[model samples]
Target chain A: AQTVTQSQPEMSVQEAETVTLSCTYDTSESDYYLFWYKQPPSRQMILVIRQEAYKQQNATENRFSVNFQKAAKSFSLKISDSQLGDAAMHFCAYSFNFGNEKLTFGTGTRLTIIP
Target chain B: SQTIHQWPATLVQPVGSPLSLECTVEGTSNPNLYWYRQAAGRGLQLLFYSVGIGQISSEVPQNLSASRPQDRQFILSSKKLLLSDSGFYLCAWTGGPGETQYFGPGTRLLVL
Candidate 1:
C-alpha cells in the first residue's frame, strides 16, 4: 500500500509571487511517478506537472516546477508568478511504474492567490 | 489527441435511489479507465479501474460497482445511494502504465 501526505491544508500567495506546496509519500517501490493536479472552481482536475523517480532532474512546465527528492520520498510543487487563476485545490499523487497504474493522492492543499 | 467525457455534469439523487455514472473516451482504443470520488475539501479516492472491456478492479470495498461494457465506455453504479456517496466523481484514462492520466469534466453527485 502507498500513501501520500500534504502537510499543509491551505496556502496563500500574492499575485506574481511564488509559492511551494509540500508533499511526501510512502512507497516501497523504487520506480514510480509523482504528479501535481490542480482543481479550480470549475471542479475540473488539470495536470500541472510530473516527475519520475528515476530522474534526478526536476520537472518544469512553464510557471510550474517540482522539487523531487527521491531519497527523501518528497515531491513538492512550486508555482512561479502565481496568478489568480492559480487559486485552486492542489493535490500530490503517487503511482507505481506497473500494475494497475492507480494513483494515491494526498489530502490536498487549498491555494489562494491574493491580489 | 485523447479526450474523456463524463455526465450529467451535475446530478441530484434522493437517498435509496440507484446510481449510474457514465464515462467515455474518444480518440483512443483499449485505454485504461478509472473512477474516483472526491469528498468535500478532500483529495481523490480511487474507486475502480479497468484495463480492458469486462475487466474491473476495485480498490476498496464499498457500495459502488463499475463495469466496462465497451472498450471506451465505463460505468459506475450502485443499487442504492447513500449520503456518503455525495461527492464529485471524476473519470480518468491513461494510454498505458506510467502514463499521465487525463481527467474528464467530472460529475457532481448530490445524494439528498
Candidate 2:
C-alpha cells in the first residue's frame, strides 16, 4: 500500500510571489510517477506538473516546477510568479508504473492568493 | 484532442435513493478510465478504475460500484445513497497504465 502526505493544510502567497507546497509519500515500488493537480473554484482537476521517479531532474511547466528528492521520498511543487488564478486546492498524487491505474493522493493544501 | 465528459454537473439526491453518474471519453480508444471522490476540502480518493471493457478494479470498499459497459463509457452507481457519499465526483482517463491522466469537470453530488 502507498500513502501520500501533505503536511500543510493551507497556504497563502502574495500575487506575483513564489510559493512552495510540500508533499511526501511512502512507496516500496521503485518505478512510479508523481503528480500535482489543481482544483479551482470550477472544480476541474487540472494537471500542474509531473515527475517520473527515474528522472533525476525535476519537472518544470512554465510557472510551475517540482523539487523531487527520490531518496527522501519527497516531491514538492513550486509555483513561481504566482497569480490569483493559482489560488486553488493543490494535491500531490502517486501511482505505480504498472498494474492498476489507481492513484493515491495526499490530503491536499488549500492555496490562497493574497492580493 | 481527447476529451472527457461527466453529466449532471450538479446533483441532489435524498437519502436511501438510488444514484447514478455517467462519464464518457471521446477521441480515444481503449483508454484507461477512473472514478474518484473528493470530499469537502479534501483530496481525491480513487474509487474505481477500468483498463478495458468489463475490467473494473475497485480501490476501496464502499456503497458505490462502477461499470465499464463500453470502451469509453464508465458509470458509477449505488443502490442507495448515503450522506457520506456526498462529494464531488471526478472522472479521469489515461492513454494507458502509467500514463498521465486527464480529468473532466467534476460532478457535485449532494446527498441530503
Candidate 3:
C-alpha cells in the first residue's frame, strides 16, 4: 500500500510573494508519478503540476512548480507570485505507472493569499 | 478535447432516501472512470473506478455503490442515504494508465 502525507494543514502568502507546501509519500515502487491538484471555492479539482519519477527535472507550470526529491520521497509544491486566485485547497497525489492508475492523495493544504 | 460532466451540481436529501449521481464523458472513448468523495476540510477518497462498461472496481466498502452502464457513463447510487455520505462527489476520466486524470465540476451532496 502507498500513502501520501501533507504535514502543513494551512499556508499563507502575500500577493506577489511565494509559498511552498510540503508533501511526502511512502511507496515501494521506484517508478511512479506525483501530482498537485487545486480545489478552489467552486469545488472544481484542477491539475496544478505533475512530476514523473524517471525525470530528474522538476515540473513547472507558469506560477506553479514542484520540488521533487525522489530519494527523500518528498514532493513539495511551490507557488510563485501568488495571487488571490491561487488560494485554494492543494492536494498531493501519487500513482503508479501501470495497473489501475489509482491515485493516493494527501490530506490537503489550504492556501490563503493575503493582499 | 475531452470533457467530463457530473449532474445535480447540488443535492439535498433526507436520511434513508435513495440517491443517484450521474457522470458522463464526451469526446473520449473507452476511458477509465473514477468516483471520489471529499468530506469537508479533507482530501479525496476514491469510491469506485471502472475500466470499461459493466466493469466496476470498488475501493471503499460503504453505503454507496457505482455502476458503469455505458462506456462513457458512470453512476453513483445509494440505496439508503446516510449522514456520513454527505460530501462533494467528483467524477474523473483518464485516457489510459499513467495519463493525467481530468475532473468534473463535482456535485455537492447534503444528507439531512
Best by lDDT: 1
Off by over 4 Å in 1: none
Q: How far is each candidate from the true structure, as Cα RMSD in Å?
A: 0.8, 1.0, 0.8
Superposed by TM-score, candidate 1 places the C-alpha of residue A84 at a distance from the truth, in angstroms, of: 1.0
Candidate 3 per-residue lDDT, tens place, B61-106, comes to 9999999999999999999999999999999999997898889999
Minimal lDDT window, size 10, model 2 chain A: A95-104
- For model 2 the local lDDT of residue B15 reads 95
lDDT of 1 by residue, B16-104 (tens): 99999999999999899999999998899999999999999998999999999999999999999999999999999999988999999
Q: All candidates' lDDT scores?
A: 0.95, 0.94, 0.94
Candidate 3: tens digits of C-alpha lDDT, residues A7-47 = 99999999999999999999999989999999999999999
lDDT of 2 by residue, A35-110 (tens): 9999898989999999989999999999999999999999999999999999999999999988665789999999
What is the Å distance of residue A24 in model 3 from its true position?
Answer: 0.2
Docking level of model 1 = high
Complex DockQ, candidate 2: 0.79
Residue pairs with backbone overlap in model 2: none
> Order the candidates by lDDT, highest first — what do you get?
1, 3, 2
